[model samples]
Target: EGAVFIPASLAYLIGTNIFGPLAYKMGRSFSSGVVNAWNELSIPLAKKFEHLLAPNAGWGFAIGMVDSAMMPIMGHLVDLRHVSVYGSVYAIADVAFCLGFAIGSPAISGSIIQAIGFKWLMWVTAIVNMLYSPLMILLRNPSKKEEKEVSFNINIKILLTQSKIKE
Candidate 1:
């Protein structure tokens, strides 16, 4: 455990320092997706070796890297929204994070491990993460101008519909 723990923590610090700045250069969505996908894909690959120091260390590093990148990307996503909705955005994010990470992941992973074992768990997780990665990479955060235009169009449509009803 110590072998894994020490390397993971050290790599986490390195990944945090590296990816935080890279997010600005590469765009948050793309950076986060690639990092996350790599992290997930690395697991099964590393697990294939089983009980080796090097592969496990690398797997731990990948885990640390993804975990480090996620928080900042989440914050960047919230920042894309309106200041008025900041509280709501953060509240929703916190709830999802808590539900998914704090509660759901552990419970689900534990069941998977019990049903099969660690080896299969890694593969299952990798498959799921790969399926989710495209969406994360492709999702666009609309610009402020686009948001205003959309809002205006909706308002106009509502007004027009109301006028037709009154007629």
Candidate 2:
């Protein structure tokens, strides 16, 4: 049971990667509606089928299949297309997917809470969250925190070594 559960959980985790991009491309309403529909549809489908078909397992399977299919296609596109074109397209898609997941998850939960009292504010925030993706796309060369940290570490090492030499 535990073994089955772990794999099912992992599949669900991997599935999100595929679904995230799909959701971004499809728009929120379509993406969410499809997912909801899938869940609803599965109940009847699972009963008719003899095999064990968990929702989480289904999600994971779908995600894995889609990602596997995408990687090969992306590779071919990269090989055929100009580097900049391929890179830009991939970067935009990646960023959009990340932004959707990062922003959308919390925003949805928070918006629901806000809607209980501050309905107008909730609407405003929803708009802002929707706007964030375009702003992210526009700001292509944002500062990378990891690079900054690495530079800081290097500087600190140099300063420490210099101080030791002076001693």
**Which candidate comes out best when scored by TM-score?**
1
Q: Which parts of model 2 have CA positions greater than 4 angstroms off? A: 1-7, 12-37, 40-53, 74-84, 109-167
lDDT string for model 2 (1-167, tens) is 34535554677577656655553344323233233334434433344333334654654554454444444344444554435357766676678768877987688757665656444444444455444534433222333335566789999999999999999
User: After superposition on all CA atoms, what RMSD does each candidate show versus the true structure?
Assistant: 6.0, 14.4
Which clashing pairs does model 2 show?
11-60
Q: Each prediction's TM-score against the native?
A: 0.61, 0.36
Kindly list the per-residue Cα lDDT of model 1 for residues 69-161, writing each as its tens digit: 556555655666545445666677668867987777788878878999877776666666667756655434544434777889999999999
Evaluated at residue 32, the lDDT of candidate 2 is 33
Give model 1's TM-score versus the native structure.
0.61
Collision count for each candidate, in order: 0, 1
Q: What value of lDDT does candidate 1 attain over all alpha carbons?
A: 0.60
